[model samples]
Target: MKVLVVGSGGREHALLWKAAQSPLVTALYAAPGNPGMEALAERVPWDGDLEALAEFAEREGIDLTLVGPEAPLVEGIADRFLERGLLVFGPTQRAAMIEGSKAFAKTLMERYGIPTARYRTFRDPILALEYLEEVGAPVVVKDSGLAAGKGVTVAFDLHQAKQAVANILNRAEGGEVVIEEYLEGVEATVLALTDGKSILPLIPSQDHKRLLDGDQGPMTGGMGAVAPFPMDEATQKQVEEGILKPLIQGLRAEGVLYRGVVYAGLMLTREGPKVLEFNARFGDPEAQAVLPLLESDLVELALRVAEGRLEGARPVWKPMAAAAIVLASPGYPEAPRKGIPLRIPEPPEGVLVFHAGTRLGPQGLETSGGRVLNVVGLGKDLEEALGRAYAFIPQIGFPGAIYRKDIGKKALRR
Candidate 1:
């Protein structure tokens, strides 16, 4: 079967890598894929035009189309392909509102008794500031619309919280903001495959969102990630029963035919695991870290899910830990310096480099976006995985390259 994976980032690169390993895949292509994926799959130019993408898929006899990024999913890429009777993995536009609109997700959680943070939505900045004073500090301020994972700010003080509100509301087109009570605990990600009925949970992973080491600085798409998060069995069970199960039922009741990965960003608080957010697709660095552990043929699994036949898919995963450390361009999550030449020495035996934002330059590969590459490492355990990843950091050289020294420090201490 021929397949086309959408998007251009490290996540797409990982998906491309996984799909290439499937013997069932006869031909593979990535729409607007990065330089790293070019080695494995044929790259097709996609200008975010859904109609054109569908046309290309039809013309190329692509058996299945997998979406990698949230933008197109939120815009109804899956719905468009399904309308054409084409097999596509990812949620429809209405189903994607769980990630596209924080307010919508919060309302759904509230209506369905899903575990989540207490939150209120606001369209007016003044009303939002008023609530800020009422709620006090240490609250999370989030843009109701997508902001590339930087939309939410965990403000420690009233001033910072208010500033976040103003920043999100002051956008040219204007947008609503959601302010939720701060839940104290370690954060982890739970990704699951669902066919609008049966839900299959994947290994839990933790993502370090801060740009600097020691969890200091602003939030980025993700600085790095580690799979098989150190979560007690009790906490895992609570998430499965109270979050993932309820979420699937809720979407079904809402008349949404969701068929794809449902990512629940959870804060494992003392009260239990509370969802922080929901993503319509796989997490970025999380995908880089987790896909390597998947022992099943991804093409077959994706096809089954897309066709709403995941009941007996029986997906399998390796019993090993994986870590992905992101290497970013200078000034990432703010003003990034681009076009700098990047020097990545040949990866050590167990390391795989997935490009996030890069391009072939006159000198060599150069940084094209904030986050440039994801260096993934696999080992018998988390520590070994991290050690394998960290050893290659020094070998990679690029002007103004920035990366966190401690990628999986949270799990390491555990």
Candidate 2:
């Protein structure tokens, strides 16, 4: 099967790399892919036009089009491809609103009796500010529209909450602001494959969203991740019953046929597992950490899901632990310092480097985005995997490069 994967992030790199391992994959292409994917796929330039992408897929006889980013999926890329009679792996526009709009997702969850944070949506900034004042401190302020994982703010005080609302309204693409009660708990991520009817969850992973260690500092896309998250069987069963199961039923109830990854950001509180948010695609560092443990052919699994036969196929995974630590440019999640030449050393066994925001410059490979690269490691246990992950950090060099020293520390301590 000829495959075309969309996006240029570390998640896309992992997907392309894993898909390349399948014997069924005859050819693989990445649209506007990063330099890290050069060895695994043929990179083609994209103009952010869905029609052009569909045409390219048709001309190249792409058997399956795997979308990696949420923006295109939210903008109806799957709809465009399906309209052209093309096989694509993603949800339609209306269904994708689960990630495209926070308010929509919250409302749908409420309608379906899905567990989530208590929230209110406001269109006017003034009303949002007033609501924040009423709600008081320690509430979460979120932009209803996508902001690349930076839109949500856990405000500790009323002033910060108002400022977050103001900031959302200040953006050109800003629309509504959702203020929700902050739930206290450890967060975990579940990336599930579904054919709009049944769902198959991958190994649970946890992402460290805060840029600094100890869960302090502002949030970027992700700082690091660990797969096969340390959750007991009871919690896992609770998540399946309280979250994943109801999610698929909710989508089916809405007459939505979702045929791709359903990334559920879950917060395990005393009450039970509550969804923090939903992403239509795989999480970045999470994908880097989790895909290495997949025992089945990624291409075959995706094709089966695209063909709506996921119920007939059984996916497998290796019983191993994996960890990924992200390397960020200076001033990441803000003004990232780009163009700094990168010097990477030879990695030892069990360690893999997945590029995220990097480009080939005239001098050499340079940092091109906030989160530049992911250093992943796999091992028999969480301790060994995390050790292997941290050991590679000293071998790399770049100006003002920042990364958390404690990536899987939470799980390791347990």
Tens-digit lDDT string for candidate 2 (185-258): 88999889888877888889999999999999998899999988988889878777777778778888888878
Which candidate wins on TM-score?
Answer: 1
What TM-score does candidate 2 reach? 0.98
- Tens digits of per-residue lDDT, candidate 1, 1-414, equal 999999999999999999999999889899999888888889999899998998889888889999999999999898888888889989999999999999999999999999898899999999999999999989999999988999989999999999999998887899999999999989999999888877888889999999998899998999999998888888888888899888889888988878999999999888888999999999998999999999998888888888888887677889889999998988888999889988888898879999989999898789899999999989999999999998988888876678898988889888
Pairs of residues at least 3 apart in sequence or in different chains that clash in candidate 2 = none
Instruction: Indicate which candidate wins on lDDT.
Output: 1
Candidate 1 overall lDDT versus native? 0.91
Clashes of each: 0, 0
TM-score of each model, in listed order: 0.98, 0.98
Which TM-score value belongs to model 1?
0.98
**Which residue pairs show backbone clashes in model 1?**
none
